[model samples]
Target: MIDIKMLIELFVFAGDYNWIGKERAIKMAESTIQYSNPVIPGFHPDPSVCRVGSDFYLVTSSFEYFPGVPIFHSRDLVHWKQIGHCLTRQSQLDLEGCRSSMGIYAPTIRFHNGRFYMITTNVKMFRNFYVWAENPEGPWSDPIWPDWPSVDPSLFFDEDGRVYITGTGGFFGDEPKGIYQAEIDLESGKLLSERRLIWQGTGGKSAEGPHLYRVNGKYFLMIAEGGTEYGHMATIARSDSPYGPFESNPDNPILTHRSTGSSIQATGHADLVQLEDGSWWAVFLGIRPVSVPFSGRHHHLGRETFLAPVTWTEDGWPVIGDGGKIAEKMDASTLPLAVDESAVSETDDFNSNRLQLEWNFLRNPQDEDWSLEERPGYLTLHGSALTLNDIGSPAFVGRRQQHFRCSVSTLMSFDPLHEGEEAGLTVYMNERFHYEIALTCGVEGRRQVIFRRRIGSLWKMELVEDFEGSDIILGLDAEPFQYSFFYSLPNGERKAFGSGECSLVSTEVAGGFTGVFFGLYATGNGKSAKTPASFDWFQYIKS
Candidate 1:
């Protein structure tokens, strides 16, 4: 038997300085704090963070998912809590018919004049807009369309109360592609000056994600380059004025993992923030490849948010991470560790009236498709005509597969009345790449469990087993290399159904900007089913 109390004491002694003394706490604060990289894991990418006093708030891109631009709040930069989404209303984010990884792109969150502003591009709409809220956890205002026609728009408020909009300048055919800047009226969203090409990045393709900061009385213009792939990088240029002949830093490409054998790759699109203690830190995006045998690189978790310390050289240039490189684990001087207990829950019994912050729909979901109050303590999904193979919205609710090794289980009560109706679990990347373990009605209306996979144009029903009950537990175990699916009855022995290669739904094979989502779904192939599926509970636990 283990000494449980002794183990608890040892764990507290390791982290809680109050258990020791104030003197030791001071020494511990001075010492480096070791933390894991990709701080906000899973499909979260294109991170932008801002500090309001001791509290830090961050936002990330949400592509075609409804309620776009998920926002997070943190006390210490290491631990984060999802507060709410910026684009909650359909008027703010209309993702209808939007393709995967093509809706919202590269949102920048900033606090100015007692208001929090979030600016980004809706690539599908070919427009740049912003929203403002009095509180970070918001009832954010509707989109205020800016006159600028570009992507990755960032707002810079100068000391003279002048507002400047800096962004990529490639949407229009006549303008030369690079970083563009112009003065703007913050209230009216009107351009006050002509947009000017600031600095073409150091001969890197796709010089975008522009951010302008006034540091040390100098305007520092930083942008992401190299197309946000293996060659992605963050570069900086400085000048006395916001727009002009800016001098590129002697050490350009301030942060990147290109051409490196490190596990973290595609690092760029970073935002800088100065802590209350006067320390500088950067929040960026990077991807971790699965440690499996594959022809080329494969990452199923998508680009995730990462943190690194930023130190300035004597020459006033910024040094990021370690020599423009970062690792999975980072040791740095940081704020005291603070964990938010309400950040997320591993299990959901569908006890609440509304869905939790972790849950997201494929796109703009139809109100008639899903319900929590219909069958109290259960999530009821009325199967729609749309299937997973369609680009349109379907009856599905999913959360990001945050951990490489984890287990997801759901108790579903569904009896398909028609042959095409299916209700069960899925490991979904997009319409073209996904794997499913579903309960359906087979020939002569015999209840069965089927395992299906869709890789590009290939669709195959790999496994099938006879099942008796309408209520069954469907589960998926995710490993570094594969996902094993299983099923069981209530209080009954579990049975292994089938498995699928993890790389099949990876970004390398699927070729998308999004990652895999462990989801519960219901569909009728091409026609709406008369039956509905009800999930009693859903659980996700990391191993």
Candidate 2:
């Protein structure tokens, strides 16, 4: 039943892809040429893309996760490989107390003078900073905090050698709001010009996520508005000069699904680039409703990165999606087919020196609390004072729950000596929204597997059964609105415990800027534990 040669080959490719393994090889056998929506899947949002010769690099918002801003390398735009993160070192960022959707906002990636530049806002922390690296997978330079007076920051190097910054908001009370711009000295990160108001959008609320580009001798300003919800839209304006009293496109709101009732909603915040073939494309963010739609079109996976072709009229303005709609299917491309097996890595063996790129903590983590080499082939997480519901970062590491129909399982060896010690698998949206099936010590040294659900201020926990709490396999299967938990006892008896409404951990219910993350966690309830919890393996498969 097993093909040894194929398995070995798959491992080779997996190592090449960093986090992808057997599942990728199996899926490659069944792979066909189909350009689908959410080209870069999962909870990756606020995509910014740029081209460097035949190579293409794209980065997306990580919000509260770290290392922040996943940087992907793509040769054919359709297939992408996450090479590394822009914020790999602690000196590059600080998200220590960042709550859900409050840390790293949106990032814009561009290339100039043989260097890769990434500029973004760190929300409540670092206001605005830019970093540069010769290679996409860095050793990047430390952040240079620029005095850009906005939230969604972008950099435009003019033909006359002036570098301009464009963004939204009034950073200071007296500064003008809407989309603002200023020229900055790149070396000193100092503003050189007075902040100027560019466009207020086409009268939409919250005109943000702006990108400026020079195409065909015209300066173009593209922005997103309507609050990043169902009413979100993309609009464009252009002028002869970068700092403009620019003219708006009569057919404004160029890219939006509002009022169309399309499955892909809130389609806006796009960045454009021209490929080697001279073909234009855009990478933006969109929310996909679950199979069973709700009154609010509640999405559980959060906003995901989507790819669509962009066409310029003979007049120079950009039009995205097919006939202004992003289609699920498109004609196959002449470029070679590439599949990202790592997007749905079937098994993470925890045998490597570093965690996979997909794994991230709630915020900036205390380096001493987690390790990969302590147990030879396991992830050892020391218990922390913070619990899942606490405001600070807990001893947690998770990957995005990208697909609605999928299963997440882990084998953990944790023996708690006190009622306060606990470790297990969790489906978490934020501090106020999550579900966990954990092994915790009870009265008289008895350890019990418990199911707990936290929604806003209410906390409900149920005892599933008793366990010795060593080398136990815990699992959660999600489908539509339901998520079921299961466990394989040390003696090999399989038991299904219970289920919860998937919406309990959804963005709509949680009221945050993120999606669900299936994570492994160890906690001390309120005190630090005496020993560490070891997880042997983790698996996430999309059905």
Choose the strongest candidate by lDDT. Answer: 1
Candidate 2 C-alpha lDDT tens digits along 1-543: 123345446665775786666566545533434577787777888999998878889999988888989999987677788889999877887887776788888999989898999999998574999999999999789999986757989999898889899889865777655898899898889999988898888889889999999888989999998888888888999999898888998878778998887788889989998877777888899998764454555788989888888887777778897756786665434333444433536899999999988899888888778999999799999889999898787999999888879988888999788877889999899998899998888778788888888889998886557776477888999997899998886569768877888877777778978888999999988899876899999999898
TM-score of each: 0.95, 0.91
- Candidate 2 is scored at a TM of 0.91
Q: Report the C-alpha lDDT of model 1 over 1-543, residue by residue, as the tens digit.
A: 123334445545755755666456545544434678888999999999999998999999999998799999987788888999999998998888999889999999999989999999998887899999999889999999988988999999999999999999875677888988999998889999998899889989999998899899999998999987889999999999999689999998899999999999999999999999998899999999866653777899889999998999899998789978988878744554565343467899999999999899998999999999999999999989999989989999999999999999999999887888889999999999999999998888888999999999999999988888899999999998899999999899999999999999998899979999999999988899889999999999988
Off by over 4 Å in 1: 1-32, 340-343
Q: Flag clash pairs in model 1.
A: none
Positional deviation of 20 in candidate 2, in angstroms?
Answer: 40
Residue 494 displacement in candidate 1 (angstroms): 0.7
Alpha carbon lDDT of residue 49, candidate 2? 92
